[model samples]
Structures are given as structure tokens and as C-alpha cells.
Target: MHFKDLFVNVSETLSFTTILLGVGYLAAFIVSVLVISENRSPAKTLAYLLLFFLLPFLGIIIYYVFGENYRKKKLYRLKALEDEKLQKRLNAYVYQRSEEKLKENELQLKDYEKLVRLLTYEGRFPLTDNNHVQILINGEEKFPVLFDALENAKHHIHIEYYIIEEGFIVDRLFDILFKKAAEGVEIRLIYDDFGCSLSKKFLKKIAEANIRAVPFYKIHIPFLSNRQNYRDHRKIVVIDGEVGFVGGINLSDKYQNEGMNNELFWRDTHLKIEGEAVRSLQLFFALNWSFCTDEGLFFQNEYFPKYEHAGDKKVQIAVSGPDSDHASIMLSYLSAISSARKCVYLTTPYFIPNESILNALKNAALSRLDVKLLVPGISDSRFVNAASQSYYEELLECGVRIFRYKKGFVHAKTMIVDDVISMVGTANMDIRSFDLNFEVNAVVFDEEINQQLKQVFLEDLHQSREISTAYWHRRRWFKHFFESMCRLLSPIL
Candidate 1:
């Protein structure tokens, strides 16, 4: 063991370590170049670059699984193709009527022509006038109507939910579905593999009851697949082509306060539609069903039955995802905000907005319009809450009033604009909903529904505590820093 030999070994070890570090950094730089070349949002590009350089190995794994935009497009390409094929068939029958309906509602929708035109130009989203829209406040209000509709289902039941947790509500739902199936009604369900907690035993029961259930983008190996990011975050139910449901509420008992699992009072929003608008929801379900099981349920008469003037309400369903040509839901929000004449009130469980949305809100407030945001006082994710809080100071400073629901977790993704337009659906006001997930929303152009939603928003304000700019700025320095850090990393969250 000579000292010269030991010194030589030490020098060799240092040389090896330096080479490894250099190689790792070089790989990170290469990936950063790829990320930037993808033409992604600036915030997202910066987030990926920071992750790559700071935590090269783990960041590479994350980017491999989640950051690859091409993988998402490839995953949903088939669905998009199938949708285009079906949309043509729909246009032959539905689009013509939609155009006529647009003309019929032109007087009421004059202020929102840009929003309507934006959505209509995106294609497949039709504006229907003969829709009977009902605002269901929470699980308590929604479940009864939904169960009644399920019980009255004559031909078939089509349901697609992001989450289907096992609980009393699900038990009741299964009972109705089983009975309906026994009565010769066709039943099909699509649940998100990433969102559902259904076990093998529960699935066996669904199969035994003769209900065809499939998972969206089945993840064979959890740690390997990128399907986790591209989720079907939609909650929709179309029964017999006459009744439809859409909103943030999932098939979980947590959304209901009367259930045995009602530990927390959960606040949410859902819509029940009984008219031509239900056909739009049916189309969305058919697309997902076809993607999951290759079952083309399009152009079926039973799924797109003719309506006889269910009501005078005008409704349009807006959907967006990675497969979409444009971010339709976000555009709808931005349009709604910018077009607002009197006020814009938005309620969402998540509040991580991108640059466009943030600027839109600030500009709206700066224009002397009443722009208010209602978020959760008690959040399920601390990091998300912090990230959401980071934007509050700026919004408040811009004269945009912010409120935190103190009564419960406000899980409603809703927006009311002026006196003639409103939105309720599954998309949150966050990056995930804007870019990563499949989301659908009902943009109602009826004054009655708008007033109803406005009333609900006003009631919720009573339960929420307004955030003052001074108070927000007075938050602890460490918390401000922590939330800023979270905001910096929010693009990936």
C-alpha cells in the first residue's frame, strides 16, 4: 500500500466523478433543447428546464413520462380521428339544426358572438336552443334527479366519469344500473384508470350485472406509461338521449353530505339537461367509449333522439384536450371574461391559471368590471393551495376580489358572466385542465340559468371570506416565498 499508489487511485476517482457530472448535465441540456423546440408555453418550458438542470436524473424521468407532448398527441390521435369521422355524420343531421339554432338565439347571444363563433369555428360544438337546463347545486340536489333519470332510462344508459370510488352512492348507482340492465337497457361505463379506485371485486360486480365497463387509456405498467397525464377528466351521463349530466361532481360519496362518509361538507356544481343539448353529451360519451372498447355507437337513433322543444334555453357544450386542435375551454373562459359587460364571477377548486387567464382577469378588473374568484379555504393539496395563493396578491392588487369558501371545499368549476351567459363543467382553472386533461363544459346563453348561477355565486360569497390586498401582502415572508416557489413549478403540477 504505497502512498503514491493511493494518490493515483484518488486522482482516478475524482476524474471519474467529474466525467459523470459532465455527462449528466450534458444530457439535461439536450433535453432542455428538445423541450424548448416543442413550442410549448413559456412557463412550461422554463419549468422543464429548471427541473432538468436542478435534478437531472429525476427530472429526466419525469420529462420522459409527462413532458413529451408528442406522446399525448399519439395517444389521443385515434380518438381524434374517430371523432372527426363521427362529427361528419353528426353535421349531416345535427350541425344544420345547430346553425339554425344559432340564428334563432342571435339576439340573446349578440354580446357573445365572438365566444360562440370561437367555439363553433373549433367544430363539433353546436349551439342548441331547445334545451331545458337545471342547475344542480351539490350531490344532494344532483343525486335525486340523476337517480330519477336513471330509473326512467328506456333504451340505454351511457356514463363516463373521471372518478368512480366505491361508496354508498356508488352502491345505489349500481343498484339502479343493475335493475336497468335487467330490464333490457344497454349500459356502458367508461372510467379513468388514473382517477378511479374501483377494485377487481367491484368490476366483477359490474360485469355480473351485465354492464359493460371499460377504463380509459388502461395503464398496464404504472411507472412506465404516460397515460397518467392525459386523463379523461369529464363527468357526463346521457340517458336514452334525452337526459344528460355534466360537471365537477364525481361518483363519490364525499361530494354528498348526508352519506355515511360525509366527514366534510363538500361544495360542488352539476347540470341536468333535458333537451337537444343532451345529444352533445351523448356524442362525447360515444367518442370515449369507442376509444376504450372500439365500439362505434355513433349515428344511432336511440342515442340521438329528436326533441320536441324541451325548453327555450340555449346551450352549447365546449370540450378541449391534447387531442383537440385548440384549447376550447380556456378560450371559452377568456372569451367570457373579456366579453363580460357587467361582472365576471368564477368558482373553481384549483386556481393555477396560465399567463393568458391571469392577464385576462387582471385586465377585466382593471377595466372597472367586477371580477371575483372563489377558491377553497380548505384544500386537499397543500402545494396546490400554496400555488393558488401565490396569485391572489396580484389579483387582489389589480382590484380583482378573491374569496375563500370558509364553509367547505368549493369544488365547483363555474363562471357567470354579466346577465346572459354562464358555464358549468369539469374543467378547473388550472394548467392541467387547460392542456393536459380531457374536459367538457356547458356554456349556457340563457338569462334564466345565468341569473340562477349568479344567485348561487352570491350565496356562496356569504360563506366565503374576501381576501384584501393588504392582508394578502401581509402574509409571512416564508409563506410568500414558498408559494412563489410553488408557483414557479406550477406548470408541471
Candidate 2:
């Protein structure tokens, strides 16, 4: 074989390979474009196209990271419409329930009206005298309150959370539940499989005690689907028919202690609503149970028992999830902001705002409404932090006051308007909380409750340092670019 013979054979093979690759690339490109265009924004469509052009293989992988949902926007819209219908039905029922008591609770008429409208709009457990709300701040406040409620469990104790750990805090809570179960207290625990997988053994212990510890939306474990998209981000503990808990706090030691787990001094907030609100929380739990277990859990005699409005505060519950397209809780937040006469004070661990929320904040500031934002001094999510910080300059320029909580992390998700009506619960100021994640937020209207939340907010505020417009302008341009990019993807994120 001479050099000339070898060159001819190799060149012919190379030509054939090139042609095959080109044809394959074109096929994939066309398929991806067709698939992506079905539901994505124009910007996302173009971003994807450019990526595919630059690196076909890696671009597809990135698509896999973000290109979920069969037809996200379409599905979202359908869910939203269905939710709207549910909202109307729910509102009617609530109004009927409250209208009867509206005259009795006449002094709190505006509060009741707000509660009914907010609950109806948000699909929160319709306000009932049989339910009550207990505002549980940190672990010091939540644990003792929750433990006592668990101890008093009668017919059943329904528990569901996004994160359930096996730490000392969880162990203590589990022990109380375990002993209560032995004493004829029915206990059903549901934790998100993905979120609580780390505590599988602890969950197993509950199962071993003849208690139901079901993993929701579980993967690969026989019955459950691996869809892994929607999760039970809600944290609610319903004890019999009289007591309940809902909010940001999870069943984890880190949230309770200085224990570290990728995050330091974990800060989060939660609610303990007894009385009629507990029934609403229980209803929310039942709906989730129906979705996950396929068992119809109507508020039958088994679940419903006699109770009264143990608390005087006018409270409304708001819930949002993948099942609902309207982003009800987020809408409620916007409503609060829009109606805010003097100030809008909000605190969250994550501050990544969606376009509508971002625009609302900007406009609120521009309108000269006192807008103060509180976030962690040390953030757990850098990308989210950058995205949050990205809005500082414009906000500050428009007279918005920003504060970084010097305390470890401000996980309390509270939003107060005119410093009168305050909301405290699991919902954060981000698209994830607004649109993607399941969340529960409480709306409190009574002056006393408002003052209580305000005092706590003020104490937290004392620990926060104001971020000046000058300081915001000093941030690197690259950071701004990254945040802006992150903001663009906020819708899908």
C-alpha cells in the first residue's frame, strides 16, 4: 500500500462521516425547535436556538435541565382556569359560612370580609369558627406549641412537610407522635420523597409503629411516579379537628438549632392555627392526600369534630402549587402591595422576584410608598442572592429602602402593608414560591395581631443594615449582568 492509496481511502471515509453528522445534527435541530416552540417564551426559544447552534450536544443537556413540562404554559393556563372555578365555589361557600356569623362577628366585619375574600381567592381553608390559628415564630415557639397539640391528638393527627429530618428535634417530635399513636391517636405522616429522603429511617420508624408515613410523589419505589417536578412544599400539622400548624418551618434540626447543612443558622417561619383555620388547613391536607393517595377524604365525622374560633385574630390562609395556574398566593401578595397605602415591608430568605412582582416593587417605590425589603446578610443561594441584589440599584434610586439582616438568616416570610395588615407564612418573594412550589401564607388583619407581627418585624429590623443607593451602585457590572440573565429565566425557573 503506497501513500497515495492510503490518502484516497482515508479521505473517502472522512467525507462519508461528515455527511452523516451534518444530517443527524439537522434532524435533532428541527425536532428540538418544533418541541421547544410549543410553549416557551420568544426569548427562551431564541436562547435555545443559539445554544443548539453553538453546541448541539451540551445544549440539549441544558434543555433537559430546564425544558421540563409537556406544555408548561398551556398546562399552567388550564390549571389556572380550573383553580379560578374552584375559587368561585370556595368563595361562595365561605361567604355563606361567614355571612351567618358576619352579624355576630360584626365588630370584625372588615376583617371577616378580608378573610373571606382572601381565602376564597387563595383556596385556603375557608374560615370556620371550628378552626384557630397560633402564630409560631421560631423553634423555641413552635416546638412546645406543636408538642402539646400532638399530645392532645384524639381521632387523628395528619402531618405533611417538605423536609422531615431525623435530628434530635425531629426525634423529639416523633417520640411524642409515637407515644400518642400507641394511646389510640391515629397518626398519618406524609413527607415529600425528594425533600425528606434523608430521613427515610426515621420515617421507617413511624411506619414500623403501625403509623402511616407515606412519601408523596415518590420515585422508583413501586407505586409512586418519578415525575419529580411538583412537591408537597407545604408544612402543615393537623391535630384532630381542633389544632393545626402551617408555615415555612420544616421538621429539621438546622432550622431549630445552629446546626449546619450547607446552610448556616437556618432561619424559617411557620404558623400554628387552631380553631376554624385548622379545619381549612385540614381541608388543604385532605386535598393533597386525595391527589397523592386517591382516597376521598371529605370532612366526615371521622375527621371533623366540634371546635371553636380559639383565637380572636382575623386570619386568612392562601395556598399555591403546580395544580393551580393562577399563582393565587402571589396574586394575594401583589394585591397587598397594590393596596398598600404607606409602606410594604417584606422579609424572605430568598428574594428572587418575578417580572410582575419586580415591576410592582419598582412602581411602588416610584410612587413614593415606603418600601423596605429584608434579606439575609449571608444567603444560602448565591444565584438567588445575585438575582435579588440585581434589583437593588433601581429600587434604591426610586426611594426603596433595602436592608440586609445581619442576623444569620431572615427566613421569616412576612409582608406587612401600611404596617397594619401583615402576612406571615411559607410563601417567599420568588417565582418558585409564587408559581412552582406549594406554599401557605397567612393574612392577619386585626390590629392586635398586626401589632404582634409588627413588634417581631421591628426587632428583626433592628438587626438589619440599610443598603444605600451608593452601595448598590458600587456592585460589579458582571453581577448585574448575571442577575439580569437570571431574572429573564425567572418565569421558567
Candidate 3:
């Protein structure tokens, strides 16, 4: 055949194939919807089907990415009710035994008593005792403590992180874990697939060392399931039914700033808690384990031990996710912000906050509270970085002090309200953390904890570049265009 004839034939064949693929995809989606509807609520099924019909290819991609169906509200409501019933029984026991402890600590945190009760009612966490928390500022302070605790594990170790990669820091930690596993310590490990896709080989080495590892919401292949919007964004580590670590720090060299990706150092915060608070961390892990593997956790056996008084710091765990009707943990942060009487200091690598949070900060600052926000001078995501600036114009106009950490990126997710209360964990001030991703936060009502967090916040301010009204107004038109584009997709971003 002639060249023109061959080209025409190929073009026609490709077009026919495309039509067939699109039609097949639509049919399969329709079939999935019909099948899912039988086992799902009417409203839930309608929403899922509408999304698939409206977005077509992208919608199907979303369905396969998330780990579970949207029928979670009703299902998990039952689970939550069951959990709450058991929790009330435990709370009564804990409250009676720790009454004196609560009185002692509550007196110290009297300024935040109403705030704590308000959050407790919001279902973020219950009041607990014999809890001690340490704010780990960087990898320098966090990793060593984490490694030390993991090294001393006796009974069991459960960990779930958003990212775990093989690098100089992780390699040595893996070495310790391997030795511990050899010693017959029960080790359970989990990481998010989307966050740690490149770390698969690293996890393989862990598997070789006989550690039980699973990827959450996997997407590459052979994954049990995934939910596009439901991410396991939590970072938790519980060891020997005792010490635990929870914060924004991931297992990567960049977190330490010892290794740089593209010459930008990643900064973050991690917390080390020992005492009654560890029970809350352990419960958080167990619930996640049950969600991933369908194993119910009992308070008997070796899952929990008789936690005693240890350090003096008071800590509580706050949990939030898509499973909840509202983002309770994020709301608790808002409550803390509203409760601020003096200063509000916040640090996060990604500052792509939603409107409510932006308003919170703006309104708080306008109310004459010193609201200081710190983000990275050079962002890992330029689109979000630009959008982050768009709000700066408004925030600055309303008296919010904006600071860009110049020496390196401020990847820490931390906030201290009024130098009296502090919140530390995996949540960021964004739609993804509040609505889509599973997140955990530790709120400490101790004066010491808040002071330490404020100290770190102040030290970081030394290296931060303050944003003036003039600077934000001088942003170029093209940058503003991309900012607007990013803001439009903030829900998905």
C-alpha cells in the first residue's frame, strides 16, 4: 500500500480502538456502580455514581486509588459507637484512678480547662492521666530517641508512616530493626503507597528481616484496595506497648537536613511520649491495623500494659479522618486558635490552608493576638507556594505576621496558642489534611510544652524572612495566575 493509504488506515484503526476503550470503560464503571449500590447507602451510591459519570476516566482512577468505599460513614459510625461504649468504660476506670493526677494537672492547665473539655466533647480524645510528652524539634532531636526506643522494644512494635525511604538514616534504623526482629520482637510496619512508592525496595529489605509490613491505600498493582481521597497520612510509632512517636517527621534523610533533595532541606517536628498517653497512641495504631487488616484489638494480652506515671508532661492524642463527619482534630486546632489570648505561632512546610483557617488566622490577628505563620522560603510545590502567597496579602493586611524560613525549609507541623497550649502531629492547615487524609495530633496542655514550642518557634523566626504588605502586592501577574489556578483545585490539591 502507498504511504498515504497506510497512514489513513492506521488513523482509522486508532480512532476505532479509542472509541471501543472509552465505551468499555464507561460500561465497566456503570457495572461497578450497580454492584456497589446494592451494598451501599442510597445517598452514598448516588454520589459515587455521579462522580464516575461526571469525571469519566478521572473518576474511575479516583475509585481505585482510595482504599475503601464511601459507605464508611454509616459503617464506621457503628464502629465508633462500639468503640465509644468501650471507651466510656475505660474512661470511667481511668478517671477514678487518676482523679488526683487530673486535679494536679488540670490546676496547672486551668487556663485551658474549658478548651480541653470542649475538645473532649468534640470526640477528638478523652481526658487521660500519667501522660508525658516531649517536643522533638528536628531529626537531630527526634530520630535518636525513636531509634533508642525501637532498640529497646521487648514485646511488640507497631508503626505506620506516610513515607519510609532507604537512605543513610533509614539504613541504620533498619539495621536496628532487623536485629530486634531477630530477637523475636513482634514488629508491625505500615506505610502509605502513594507517599512511599519509591521506598518499595526499602520495605522489601524490611520484609527480608521478617518484619510484617503492609502498604496503605496502594495503587501500583495487586493492592487489596484503595480510596482516592482516603489517605493514611498518620505518622505513628508505638513500641513495647509503651513509648511512642507521632509527628510530621517521615523516615527520610531530608527530614534531618543531613541529605538534601535539590539543595532544599526538609524540616519537620516529631513527638516522643511515654506514660498514659502512649495508650492512646497504641489504640490509634490498633484501630488503624483493624481498618487495614480487619483485626479487632482487645485490651487484654500484650496489646496494652499497665502504664504508670513516668515523665511529668501531660499529653493527649487527637484523631481525625474522612471516617468522621467533621475533622475533629482540625477543629480542635481551631478551638485552640480561638482560645489564644496572647500569641499564636504555627510552622508547616505546606501552608495551603482552606478559607476557614485563613479566616481564623486573619481574624485572630485582627483581634490583636500575635498570629505568626512560618512556611518554607523555597517550597517543594511551587503551585502551592504561590497560592500560599496569595493569602499573605490578605493575612498581612489583617495584621498576621508571615515569616518565610530562609536558612532551610520549615517542614514542621506545629502550633502553639497563647504560649499556654501546643498541638503537634501530622495535620497541616489544608483541605487535604482536614477532609481527605487520615491525621493524628497530640495536644499538650502543659505550660512547659507550650513554652518549649514557642521557644523553637521564636528561634526559627531568627532565620525567617518577614513578609511585608508591599512584597505580596509586588507579586507578578503570572505568579498570581498560577496561584488562582492552585486555589481553584485546593480541594483536590
Top candidate (TM-score):
1
Question: Sorted by lDDT, highest first, which candidate order results?
Answer: 1, 3, 2
lDDT of 3: 0.75
- What lDDT score is found at residue 417 in candidate 1? 93
lDDT of 1 by residue, 139-253 (tens): 9999999999999999999999999999889999999999999999999999999899999999998999999999988988888876778899999999999999999999999
Candidate 3, residues 35-103, lDDT tens digits: the string is 475564343444456556666676566655652455354333324236777768765755454444457
> All candidates' TM-scores?
0.94, 0.84, 0.81
Error of 2 at 382 (Å): 1.6
Candidates in order: C-alpha RMSD to true structure: 2.3, 4.6, 5.5
Residue 151 in candidate 3, Cα distance off native in Å: 1.6
Off by over 4 Å in 1: 1-17, 78-89, 92-95
Clash counts per candidate, in order, are 0, 15, 6
TM-score of candidate 2 relative to the true fold: 0.84
